[model samples]
Target: MSHFGFENDIHSVLKLDMPITNAPMARWQRKASTSTSAHTGALSPSKSANRSLSLSKTPSKTPGKNGKTQSTPSNAGGDRFIPVRNAKQMDVASFLLSKENEPAEESTSAQANQQANQKAWSVTLNGYDLEEAKILHLGGKPLNAPEGYQNNLKVLYSQVPTPVSMKKSRYISSAPERILDAPELRNDFYLNLMDWGRQNLLAVALSEQVYLWDAAQGDITLLKKMEEENSYICSVSWSKDGNFLAIGTSTCKVELWDVQYQKRLRCMDSHTTRVSCLSWNDHVLSSGARSGLIHQHDVRVAEHHTCTLRGHTQEVCGLAWSPDGRYLASGGNDNTVNVWSGAQQTGVHCFTEHEGAVKALAWCPWQSSILATGGGTSDRHIRLWNVNSGSCITAWDTQSQVSSLVFAPNYKELVSGHGFAHDQVSIWKYPSLAKVTDLQGHEGRVLNLSLSPDGSTVASLSADETLRLWKCFEKDPSKKAKPAGASSSIIQQHIR
Candidate 1:
């Protein structure tokens, strides 16, 4: 079995034109009795001298103390390269494949496999990336895309975005998303008139009748009609869960309606004067009265006011509870904003900045301590306060009478509806106190404002007897689908 003779046979089978030069390399072999090649020949002495070098097999692994190798055993008959150094080196295929797929490999450095990690996402924009090479992380998963990441699906390859376009203020629709006539809506300034619920229903009071308008379906249902003479609907507040609607009337009686059944569930007539304003916290209903007193009614089982809050000198017209349902903000014609800690029956803090009546009240979405209060024609200012310390954070002169204010649930902005000259809805860039835009459509003074659940739209009811919807802010369902675990520190939010 001359090695050169075997080479001639392999060369005849493979039909090689170049002569075999590398000797220490191994050649293909078969079982002792069978071979794949059909030809047979004898090798020369020079080639046979190098044949031994190629015939060497990889070294075998030494048995460990536990008497076992941790790696998978290689198949003896599988196609593999036999390293000349040892007999049990096993197969180097996995390692060789890994390097072949590497960004740089010696033999094919210039033409290495260009495939990249498809799940990777590299960031390069300012504030979005720490540096050009730094990979972004989401839920602790690194987005270290390959150097030339054409296959990275997590990244978007495009032109650099314009910064000025992003920082610019947004303008809302000049026309409403909807317009409906509130023919019987009361024009009184001291009355709390309407509220929107998470159930996609807007409850509006028309004279003595309470109607529920389905914002999603455009269907309206009369929830209740006053049964007593001279009794009319004055205030309406939706329960936190949107399962019920609380109605306060001119009879000083507060009634709860189960929205699911469209029927009255309970009634409480504890106030001496007309029930003018209403707000809800969980199962508790707080009703502000023309008597300048606030009464808390436990809707769970009570028929009377649970506890009375005596603070205002005049009518308590505007009222709001913190989202947590732990604190309350009350505005009275006495030109005062009362912040009450739920722990106490009386107001723990009182702020009197507005010279006229304070009617508009809104709690900041991001900063819970911050409260916004709007004044009447004489004051014409929207003031933000730190409820905990009773310090005024910022205030913006609306110029017109501040009728109502509501904070965008998702974005850091608050919208105020004004009366008098403008009768406008002004959206300010929140804590910054910069006006983003003012929307005007109503014919008369804007009396009340309410926000839709899921925080997409706002409904403003004006004294012109028209209800308008403002499509203010909407959330991207895709980014919302991302796991909440993504860190805001590196999160890139598109604000428009």
Candidate 2:
């Protein structure tokens, strides 16, 4: 593939075109021609002057401007004179030789300095030894390269590169390490049926029961089972403290259970429809219902329902609170995402970019305002939005229904549970939006996905009624994290 303008070497990029100077070359050329004509006795002016004895045989006196007579050449005495060894004769001959190349019609500026230039040349040439003088006039070599010598292009092959470690991964594994069965796991599209707690306990709502499975110990404890006729656990969320688990039921009441004591501490009963999504911000447990009402419950107080956000039309299936507890993002089956800032009951901004139900809502752990939401089958786009500006910053086509989106706690990569043509979990390399890999063991839709505090392990609950634990995001032991397999016992309970 052609890289357009980018595939060039450093030389082409900088364009180092140094100007070749001609001033020095002109001076050297003139000197060479003059020297060559005298040696070869060519038809040039210097050769003609030498053949006829235009230079004087002896120095004669000429009247000077100062009336102090100066010695000068009188006239040509003969066709040739016997060569003399005297230094004065050689000096005169050198002076005459220097002037032999000048044209009669040359500039007067050159003629004015003729005598002085000749005297300098005469003195300089005689000072050099005969051996050194012979070496000085190397007239045989061509000064520059002969005409059409183009530089041959040597195709550059890069050096044998040091093998780069292919194992260096910024995100967790794309493949799941183990699969656990969450039998009777609901196949609903609008319910957030599972969550991983910071305390290593995974809370999953399987049909009518909300089970708290000890992720650190290979044991499962039935936390709560709906006995109230038609009511079933629809959603599950873990509080920031990890000691508490919030279970939302079809009856529209949210039960705050104390994980340590194994008892219901509080029940928030304000919603009219089934509570589909639950998110926690400090002491506040915000629950969204099928009625599209968002009730904020401060669990520590009796008047738990402090403020109610009214915006979504359909069932609110996806919910997330920012890490700092400043903003709340919620996605609904109405195909809209709402950003609720502060304690306001009304959504500050509403986004309707998805054509299908917007059920996957994730707040970036690294960025406070960036919210990532995924659409259903009709809209298979995962868009990153800036809540403050109400603008969609970037989007990616999952090419399948995006059931869930969760960013890795340690790396920027995002894990998306998909349905349709690709009923698998795909991990993407963050902002680059490149698919790192896909975990593909589930036979059906991946309904929900949760990440461990270690950042590497991800638990996927699929519609196939199987819960998979992927060390897909397992990190290096040297990295700042809980020791590897510190909670490996969580997989000890064999679920056939």
Candidate 3:
């Protein structure tokens, strides 16, 4: 039969019962069968000539390796190209209609052979036992080996050394825990107007008045208010027992008051100039004045004046008694730090290291011989000194005026209040002097810093008339908090 007649017979045999209208289904037939038009009319001569020329130009087979002729798909380079599918290629319709196979146990001897090979390898390894290890230390001269040393591979297990425990890191909250409006607070850098007492009370002197904030009760009490004009409070300090508070005035007077009765116990007028700083050492209260004189007053007797210390040439703005009460540290506007022995009337060591006014001073609670002092804007340095040796241990440039310094009672850390450029509070690691965190919120220079009795909170006062409290130090959870004013009874007996 003719080729066209054979293709027509095959199409008639494979045709479905229903008529299909899809173009793709129609075009899926062999190219030779689809070469004629649906109207069955013969092509024009020009079109037939062009088709014969295109067919002659396209080579059906390409010459491949070893004189082999490979058949190339006829539709590969055509305009309406359809890819020829191979057995390895996926059938999307078939895959979409296919169902998952049932799970069955594979019974192939290849897996058993693999297991047998692994068992043989493991048994071969177990035949040799390594009971000892000998290490050859290379790079050095050869040493004679002991007799009967075997030259064989051996393994030895050594006990691992325990790792050293790392020190716990400290975290300080950057945000202020509490904020209070301190209206009319003095802006003078020479004044020390804020102090946290051992009774858990915060004493803040605002211009002409002094107030006591009870941390336990969350109440404010008017400790004392100066009614006279031009007579304002310059400094405030709490006694060691927290039963009394010392008030320094701009009028060159120092007044002692009993907080329990809210009455004045006695007033010391030994200072010729304004008293700028006050520190209590047991029954004796030391006051630093603008005259550069430090007066020791015995509050128990009618004659309160004891010994007068004359070392500073300018106003003495900072004073701190050592934890053991064996030494007294005084910082003055003369840029000098004077350390006085308890029994001597003159300073034992007068450190002239600071270039600016030294008003910030703190004694290490853990080390009685170490003292920390900070300088004003001209100096901007924090110096740690060993009072026993009269030598500076270390010093750091704070870059800002140091206004106040307070050592954390329970921690080996120090908190400093700064002014001038940055009105912020800084917490420093002791000995290392590395800064842990900077707590900032004040709009003006920080003028004062005080630590709570528990040493967990720090109270900062700034020239902007705002008082901020930060939870800078954390309390030791292993130890219980001591009762406030436990030693007050003993102190009260002496006062009574």
- Cα-based TM-score, every candidate: 0.63, 0.63, 0.63
Give the per-residue lDDT of model 1 (tens digit) for 39-138.
2787665765455444443435545689885443576533476556543343476666776677644546434332222112223223233333233434
Every candidate's lDDT? 0.76, 0.77, 0.81
For model 3, state the Cα shift of residue 123 in Å: 52
Ranking 1 against 2 by lDDT, winner: 2
Quote the positional error of residue 255 for candidate 1 in Å.
Answer: 0.3
Candidate 3: residue pairs that collide: none
Which regions of candidate 1 deviate over 4 angstroms?
1-171, 476-496
- After aligning candidate 3 to the native by TM-score, how far in Å is the CA of 481 from where it should be? 19
**Residue pairs with clashing backbones, model 2:** 172-472, 172-473, 173-472, 173-473, 456-473
TM-score of 1: 0.63
Clashes of each: 15, 5, 0
User: Which of 1 and 3 is ahead in lDDT?
Assistant: 3
Residue-level lDDT tens digits of model 3 in 81-174: 5677876566764654452232233324546777777767766786532211235433344333222223323312223332221023244555
The deviation in Å at residue 160 for candidate 2 is: 15
